[model samples]
Target: MKISFLCILIAAIQPFLWAGAAKFGGQRSGTRYDNRAPRDTLAHLSGWPQRANWAQQNSFEAFPIFAAAVLMAYAAGVPAALIDFWAVCFIVARFAYFACYVANLATLRSLVWFAGVIACVRLMCAAI
Candidate 1:
């Protein structure tokens, strides 16, 4: 697969990592991961775990526009190198965003989130 397409797969899978962190990361209060009531359990998480869950939700929220942008870039015949570059940018920014969220670095997270958005927008605009 092209790297950009692979990036889409990575993007799709990234949120699960944050979910796992929210459920399984250190700082839990004697409660096992409640797969049976995951959302409820996650909703009660605090500190970094809570932040991880938020990151997971944000990651899910971010995926569609990014995926559409990449596909649009492909359909519009954007250069493969440029597509790959922007996709990589998005992935890197997202990873940073996740870290910042978990670390409670709100300002840095917002900046990285903007970076990811810019990457997606660049991809979509390249098609236009």
Candidate 2:
């Protein structure tokens, strides 16, 4: 349940990267972005090329594991909690990965990525 809540929080806020976003108060001086797309303050820009990169990278980060988890749960007759845990991991890991990527923290990003993948694998194995 905690992970579920966190997952929703991640998903809800992520698109603010592309959508119009701004810091509420600044002398055009203190915020990373006072009047720019939130993506600009990010380590990478979000032009078409960047958006495509985001799409590809994010899909790789989350979808396959989700599909595997669902199918595995159905086929192996696993309980809902196991699948939910995997889904939660997928969501949280994506959040962590995005944060690390934006901050340009190369090493920690990979660790977070691997953790997510491992959580997915664990869920599948438990299902089976």
Candidate 3:
């Protein structure tokens, strides 16, 4: 498989890392996992834990666009190396985004999010 495809797999699992952070926080706080009202519980989380939940949501929101971009680029015969580079950029930006979110660096997080979006856009443009 191409490295870009591997990055897609990494992106697919990124949200789970953030979700695990949230769950870890809940465990630390002695809160039982409530399947029925999970969102309600997560909604009340504060600090890094709350940010982790938000990050997870953002990761989910970004996945489809990034995945589609990769697929489109491949289908349109974009060079594999170029696609791989941008895919790596997206992955790095996402990692930075997650770190910034957990650290409460709102401005930096937003910037990283923008970088990730740009990476996705570039990948799509390369295909066209």
Candidate 4:
């Protein structure tokens, strides 16, 4: 499979990773995960768990655009190396953004978000 295609899978899965962390990462702190009422559980989370939930939400928001960009680039006959490079950079930036969000590094998270956006924009431009 093309690396860009693989990145779509990774990007899809990334939000679940954050969701898992948000649900389970705070279990030891006396907040049991409410599987039946997951949204309620997430709503009460604070600190890292809360931030993890935010990260998960943002990941979901970002995925469609990234995936569309990759598909568009492939459809437009953009070079594999270029597509793969931006896709990988997007993945790396998202991971960094997640870490920064959980750690409360607001400024750094914004910078990383810009990097991810740039990757998606590059892919879109290449497709054009």
Candidate 5:
């Protein structure tokens, strides 16, 4: 399988990492985990934990675009090497994005988010 396909798999699970961090961090804020109403529970968290929750949600939001780009690129016969490069770039940018979010580096996080978007766009362009 192409490395880009592997990236798709990794990206699929990336959001859970942030979600887990948010859960653990929220526990630090004395917020009990409410399995029945997790979003409400997370809403009560503050500081880094809250940011982590947002990061998790953003990761979820980003996944579909990235996944669709990869699938479209593959279907359109984009070269594996080029697709892989952009896919890796997107994954790295996402990791940086998540770190910046948790660190409360709003500017850096926004920049990283843009970088990830660019990577995804480039991957999609490769299909044309």
Candidate 6:
């Protein structure tokens, strides 16, 4: 199936997040905290914000593909409203996912993931 630009956009974001990850710790030591280096291996291993950044970047990669699905619907001339609804849900879910992900809240992150899945279903239904 042909993916749309929106999907591509979502996919593109993951690498960008990865690129921004802490050189030694994702969120600290930028002269903010007294800590010279983050003690968390997650930050130092991958660097910055530790596990959160890793998870965030991992989750972030999926958006553009979802966006592509939305775009595909548009190109196929599906109703704009349907596409709009799906897009909004997708974006919101991703944001929530990111927030919960970085915070390391597994429960909320799962919910957010489900919401994104719902968005995909909605998009697929609309396209079909």
Each model's total of backbone clashes: 0, 0, 0, 0, 0, 17
lDDT (CA) per prediction: 0.93, 0.56, 0.92, 0.94, 0.91, 0.62
Q: Model 6 segments beyond 4 Å from truth? A: 1-11, 14-48
**lDDT (Cα, tens digit) per residue for candidate 6, span 6-118:** 54465467545643453334445552322554334344443235555565565655655576678678877887767776777776777677667667788998999888888
lDDT value, candidate 6, whole model: 0.62
Per-residue lDDT of model 4, residues 1-128, tens digit only: 28889899999999999999998876855678988999998988988989999999999999999999999999999999999999999999999999999999999999999999999999999999
What TM-score do all the candidates reach, one by one? Answer: 0.95, 0.55, 0.94, 0.97, 0.95, 0.65
Instruction: Score candidate 3 by lDDT.
Output: 0.92
lDDT, ranked from best to worst: 4, 1, 3, 5, 6, 2
Model 3 earns a TM-score of 0.94
lDDT of 1: 0.93
Q: What is the per-residue lDDT of model 1 for residues 1-128, given as tens digits with 9 covering 90 to 100?
A: 29999999999999999998888863365546767988888888888888999999999999999999999999999999999999999999999999999989999999999999999999999999
| Candidate with best TM-score | 4
Worst 10 residues of 1 by lDDT: 25-34
lDDT of 2 by residue, 1-128 (tens): 34434454554555454232222222132444424554454334443334333533564446655566556765786666766677677777766776666565779978987887787787678776
Stretches > 4 Å off in candidate 3: none
- Model 3: per-residue Cα lDDT over 19-83, one tens digit each: 88997887687766677998888887888888999999999999999999999999999988999
Lowest lDDT sum, 10 consecutive residues, model 5, at 1-10
Give the lowest summed-lDDT range of ten residues in model 2.
18-27
Candidate 5's clash total is 0
Model 4 compared with the native: what TM-score? 0.97
